[model samples]
Target: MKPLNLAQFHLLIIAILLPVFSMARPGLAQIPKEASQIIDDVVVTAEKRKQMLKEVPVSITVIDDLEIQDRNVRDVKDIFNLVPNLSVSSQNQNVTYVGCRGVSPSMINRRNPFVMYVDGVPFSKISGYSADFTNVESVELLRGPQGTLYGKNAMGGVMNITTKAPSNDLEGRVSLDISEYETYLFNANVSGPIKKNTLFFGLWASEYQTRGYMENDHPDQDYYDDRNILNVRGRLRWVPSEQLEINLLSGKEIRQGGDGPMIGDSQIRFHEYKNPDDYVDADSFDNALHARFHAKKFDIVSTTTYRNATEDYDVDYSYGSSSVSHGILDYENTTFSHELRLQSPDDRDGIAWIAGGYFEYDQDKDNEMSMQYLPTAMMNFNRKTDWPCTTTGKTAAVFAQTSIPFFNAFKFTIGARYEIVNKEMNYHRTTTNLDTNTVVSSAAYTIEDDWDSFTPKASLDYRISDNIMTYVSVSQGYLAGGFNNTIDDPDATTYDPQTSTSYEWGAKTSWLNNRLSCNLSIFYMDIKDMQVTEYPSAYVMVASNAGKAHSYGGELEVKFRPVTGLILSTGLGLVQGEYDEYMGYGGEAYAGNKLKNTPEYSINAAIQYRHPSGIYTGLDVQGYGKTYFNESNQDNSVRDPYAVVNLKLGLELSHWDFYVYAKNLFDEEYYTSIFTSSIRNSYMVGSPRTIGANIVFRF
Candidate 1:
């Protein structure tokens, strides 16, 4: 595929917008009434309650149902391009790493700096973070420290998703999608009222399949294949009186597929494993139940969830020869969680306040097995090994936030949260040495820890006018402590949580009769007790707390509708993150080194036009500056800067819609993620250009 030049890109954008501009007069009936209504009705979950997006003082991005349907985003990862200061990388089918504001975990076992929530329920377990989002209604991203309201594991930020609920009106939709790359997707949803005011029901399901992108070139000719995923959800809402309302929801997801393939080998020209069939087979299922009650003065919510995930992977020992095999390894895990929260009502007087108490419990069980592929006699040692472990944790917190109107134009907000966390772990390992041909058994050991954390936040907002506001805030946040199950050393119990104090100032303004809006913010964070990982052996990695670090960044976002049928959005972010103290090879000074997997600068912009004659077109561009792969700041191996552009052209009639999209239109070569190790290093390559079209009919 040929890359598009800068001039060619601009021409394409002009072609998309010219027709729409010619059809509709400038500044006349351009904005759709429905779209304006949706913007006015935008509600957010960032404040731990429902509030309008324009009213909240925090930084938040919302992708509503219209955006979700128009963008054709398949998964949660696909939404990263639409948000600022957020990024995602997929390691495998069920494993993904996400970061916000340069705050992400070193690996899988550590506590996640960013917390994910479904509806009002917190999804805390490691396995539940990557749950499918087939039936989602909206996704909200809250930036900056959030510990005062959300508690532990929200040190970086939060991602909250709300699923579709049952409706009083009878309506349903079904969709089937097919692509040239042998990808298939099917989705169906139905909802209606069972009774006038007492009952309602909703159900949704989705299935997807795709062929592996890599070629094995081996005899098996087996491709890395993935199977269908099934999901179903139901909702019930009852209003017995004018001031009382009860809602209940239940959902489940079942998935089976091949683990994502490794894009590159440490040593090229050694075709050790070229076939996707040699990849791992992974599967997972998640089920959840939630209930909430809304009253005049108080609200209570409860959630119960269970998850099971399993993976079976094949490892080849040699670089070139397919004959060598380390056999197959399997990992299985199960988790159960429950949470309850009680929230006070919003105040209407001079002091507006909200107070809440929260409690959460989580339990996880994990098992791993090593199996031999060859015969027992040829193995010469025990062919199977078993490692089983269990972890239990509990958290209790009390939080409160109050806003005082000191003057007509100025308001002060104060918030605080106190949290207590307790964790316990039990593990046992049994293995056989291949050389000695003898069994090695290890007894189970137990570890326990308790911690108390306090977080506080203060902010002041001044309303210059009805359409403009300026605010400044200072907040402290903390992540929870957890056990390192991947570590082989018995002494590697738990690492302390990371803490940060962030200071931010920002302004939001609207002009030109609400057709243009802009927001800008500058922030600095001082992070202490950073958690870092060290690899002593080929497969053994240990987690520990490191010295302090610092990050400073700025973000600018603008949305403008210059004329009728024309919309433009642009965002720019510049970040400089570094570690104050870090130990590297030969004990070199690494104080000024850049943080891993973070770019110093990024830019995103998009333009869309819709004509009165049922034509719609858009163009999007995103760029990422140079970044280092490791905290040691190695110059020899670094990911170069890159830019990607996407194009969309569509036409809509009364009941018909058609569109074509070209993603990564330039076909640029880049790395989505990079991991380095002394024994074996790897880098995951980004996807190439894809051009496809879709047609939809509404009845």
Candidate 2:
């Protein structure tokens, strides 16, 4: 592999500041020849508590620090192939859309089905998702319902992320990457002690900028949707005694405006328009305090968090027609949450238990939205519309779970959560013809409602043998109810919460003296009052309860270390789901239609090798089966099955690592995002073949 050019080095100085990226040297002395072909142990916090991977009864996909760096996963979207029965993709620079299992968040509703938590604090509002990962210790994906512990919006699953804590010993890493589309990244992280074991501090910074890949109509503007992102975080840790540990963390991310939401009339990704200069800018800030106290009888954990996020957008909505229309949207959210939990002493031989209480307040919406049109040659009149609204939610829940060992080989676990939620919204809308100086339409209303939910979970674990463990579990989960912001009638203002009941059976095993590992899981789910979207008016959508639906699926993950320096892994997923009864968009009877954006199958495989000469090479393949983007299951809008491969080769040396890689090696063309609505279908083109190089320095 060739070294990065001098220009590439200069570009790296422009972006990123980070935590981890330690890979590339495994083929030389990387393993020290003492690894003995034994696979590494994986530990996860799946149950709101830490446990060995094999002992956890849930189907989980854990990405540790090594894999994060090795796989070049800067953020969650890069792990789409690492998890089964999941669709992970990015929206602009701030939003990451994850469709877990068979359930997905509706395009109209702002709430995501799956919930994400960072260092014990949940993002009460999805808008504040951290777009980059810095100094992360691990990321866990728990598939299926988890309401008993996660409370609301976990009807689908959960993402538990842990960031590395400050350490007494000084440690640091800096890396640079240059790729196609004028993409450049710079990441750095440092941690040390201020007073030996008593106090420590850490800081991380990263900047990412991309000129984009999609073509634009303008000759000079090569590609649309350019992006610039900056993230920085700091941590302070206090270890006063053996009984207590506390950490305070604060972070901020800024997304500079590059362009607005891309939408096209057809599935083609190319954008053709008059003014492509407008864009959207977004910012997010977060602060969290986490404390862990070791008591004589139990452990107490407390977390307090506050976050503020804002976004602004200005775009031209002229659908390639002669007329011109423009829209401006400003949005903001403020969230505060506190959680306190007590856990039985870990490493105890007896029963294990956890009980906790949580409270969160979310200001989901906080500004007025407007749409305007200018008088053009083809149109004679000028018009404008404005809607102002404030939406907020308050949620409180108490949860508890216990695991009891019995018969020397069997264990049973049960948990439940009782939650009360309330949402309030006050909105007003007005439309006027500017030239005529007259009001054409106006509406206003205020709505407030409360909901109560009781979710329970139970599971049985059996140790068939020292190498194999099996489990069966049943759980219930639900999403909170809320009102629509851009609605014309108050009668269509609110939508009920959707619920799911899931049953699952799974097995985890190791063979060949820990050289090979395999895990399997099968699940069935019944959904009631499924939330579906309606698009009667352009840019105005509503959420309502559809009738029912059911889904069944299976997943398998395997890893084999056949020889000392070679590793092979594969993941497969199968799913079949359909709406049992429902009225879809436009009040159409769409019962028995397949769920949108869900595929029939998914597959991912990888192979890696390390040579004793400090050389490494790897390849990965990932693909998804047939997928439809609309409720009608139309063939024209289907996402045909496609697969892409990536290759990487690098050399590792003391204090430095060099690597070259190519994504979409064959230059495959695919869609990264697909959205279908009454107005038009918008698509974001996936990355094509791009070659890049990464260089790392550690101290």
Prediction 1 global C-alpha lDDT: 0.66
RMSD of each: 7.5, 4.1
Candidate 2 Cα RMSD after full superposition onto the native fold (Å): 4.1
The TM-score of candidate 2 is 0.93
**lDDT tens readout by residue for model 1, 82-187:** 7777666655555566666777777635346777877655654334355445567789888889999888888778889888776565545445555544555556
Regions more than 4 Å wrong, model 1: 1-41, 108-110, 124-128, 131-135, 225-228, 266-272, 275-350, 369-387, 434-437, 440-444, 486-492, 584-589, 635-637, 697-699
Give candidate 1's TM-score: 0.86
lDDT of 2 by residue, 1-699 (tens): 011234455444423322123343222212122224788788787886778899989988887776676678877667666888887544555566667777877744576787888776675343545545758888998899999989889887888888888776677767788888777777878788899999999999887777666566755455666777789989999999999999999889888745433546545544655255567678988889999999988999999999888988776666454446666768898889999999997766679999999999988664758878775454677888888788888999999999999998899999999999998988788888888878999999998999999999999999998889999999998988888778878887888999999999999999999999999999999999887776777657778888898889989999899888788889998988898999765778878888876778888898888776768788998888887777788665577788899999988765567889998999887776666766566665677798999987665
Most TM-score-accurate candidate: 2
The global C-alpha lDDT for each of the candidates, from Candidate 1 onward, is: 0.66, 0.79
Q: On a 0 to 100 scale, what is the lDDT of residue 405 in model 2?
A: 91
Q: What is the TM-score of each candidate against the true structure?
A: 0.86, 0.93
